[model samples]
Target: MKKFLIHIPLLVLSTTFTFISCTSSKNVDTNLPKDIAERPADEDSQKYEQAQLDKLKASIESESSREKCANASEWTFAPMGAKACGGPQQYIAFPKKMETTLLPRIEEYTQKVKAFNEKYNIVSDCMMIMPPTSVKCINGKAQLITAEQ
Candidate 1:
């Protein structure tokens, strides 16, 4: 009877150990990629990510330039000059008549800026056009008569 009791406890203990070991082994991790050759290709994914970043940068630049244009107090009719002008009094040669080409371009640019602003939810009082009397031509260059002038 004593031998039977001791054998029964040993049997139960061995059964418990077997169950624990089986459960632990089931939780082992074995699905990890074993080598670089087994990994997924990243080249195409990298290019796609770079293109998206470039597009975002371009949008930001466009928005920034539009905001600057909207905040500008005066517009100049500068041709044969840098794509962008600086300062209040600097001037560049005017290539066409102000009433036709220059005014139209200004209007077009303003409309574009307005549309961009509306799309991006930017708030500003831009696109204010100065009167003809506010314009002055010197050495074939047209400039706005700023307050300092």
Candidate 2:
């Protein structure tokens, strides 16, 4: 009887401690950043990726500009940017001579842009980019034109 009385208090204290511990609030780590980039790489990587893509685009454009478009036959158009909804975002004009070099890079760029769009869940206008009907050489640069133009 005497030992039971001593153990009753111990049991009550242990139960009370368990309840108190169970009810105690714990800190949850919420890594919320202000004005954060939509990407997981978070900051510099996105900018670097975009910049590299832009640089490649600029280089490809430079390749097409190496010669005057005196002959429209010497020029052709390639699709650019893989749109989310389907079709290319735009068309690029390149010299037929540079086709061997430019086509692969253009394909690479398109693939990368497609990946970026998919990765970042980038939304784009669903308007389908119709292929240019013909290449036009107004002055020196090659231009893509529709049948109406």
Candidate 3:
């Protein structure tokens, strides 16, 4: 009877641990977007492109600061590494009525960046950094939602 009581507690403890381990092992999938899985694998290329992006962003910030446009929003492209760098990234939005006045300048700046990348042969296989055409604003910041087809 004494031996049975001691074994009962041990059995309960082992059963509890087994149940906890089994339940914890089943992780829920968040179901992220397909584009996230398709990012560039080349670390060197990603770094080079990110530098070009930073320069373009600086130009845009200088230009925007002068205009002081209210509620001005733009779609910005970011490589996986750029998100880790702390600074304002340049975003180019298309010709929407809300941002019509800024479109021409943005377009010119984007073209310059494109030219620089071409001159230096800094390119990426990933579509996100290769000139994304569509974006969605999340948490008051533009996120690349789609790549150019």
Candidate 4:
């Protein structure tokens, strides 16, 4: 019974110590003294922060430009089945508006592409070209010629 009582006090002390050790204290300046030195902002840190802000602004501008491109009444040409050359080429607008919406315009273009593919006796040397409103299938591929040259 004596040993148990002694151990109980020791256990309480250890628990109190553990609690004290685990408790996080924030060092806050409650009493502001006039003579306390105000820490100056580092020049390098300021420059880094400004650079990050500039990058963020640039990114925002880029995103806005892309949104404008996507929403604009512009036509995009794609080759029928050419893996590299047959995707959304560029923003082209016809003299007349195709439709009021983007989806219909894309669908119309897709049909045209399918027809072009069937009509043209295309080989690996075929190139899709954009001259404003129409997609032209040229005889030779630009990439192949460039590589050869």
Best by lDDT: 2
Q: Tell me, by TM-score, which candidate is best.
A: 2
Candidates in order have lDDT scores of 0.44, 0.83, 0.51, 0.41
For candidate 3, lDDT tens digit of each residue in 15-49? 99999999887875546446954654564565666
lDDT of model number 2? 0.83
**Per-residue accuracy of model 2 over 124-147 as CA lDDT, tens digit each:** 889987899999898787888986
Window of ten residues with lowest summed lDDT in model 4: 140-149
Off by over 4 Å in 1: 1-98, 124-133, 138-140
- Write the residue-wise lDDT of candidate 4 on 3-103 in tens digits: 99999999999999888776643354656555535544465454444454445434433432333232222433222222123543334332123334433
Model 1's TM-score against the true structure: 0.28
lDDT of 1 by residue, 1-149 (tens): 98999899899999999999999998877887899778765744544444543454355334323322221234344321111121111232233323354444444444444444444455443433332334454443344564556
Could you tell which candidate, 3 or 4, scores higher by TM-score? 3
CA RMSD of all predictions? 13.8, 8.4, 15.8, 19.2
The Cα error of candidate 2 at residue 21, in Å, is 39
Poorly placed runs, candidate 3 (over 4 Å): 1-56, 59-98, 128-149
Clashing pairs for model 2 are none
TM-score of 3: 0.30
Off by over 4 Å in 4: 25-88, 92-129, 134-149
Error of 4 at 62 (Å): 12
- Backbone collision tally, model 3: 0
What does the lDDT come to for candidate 3? 0.51
TM-score result, candidate 4: 0.22
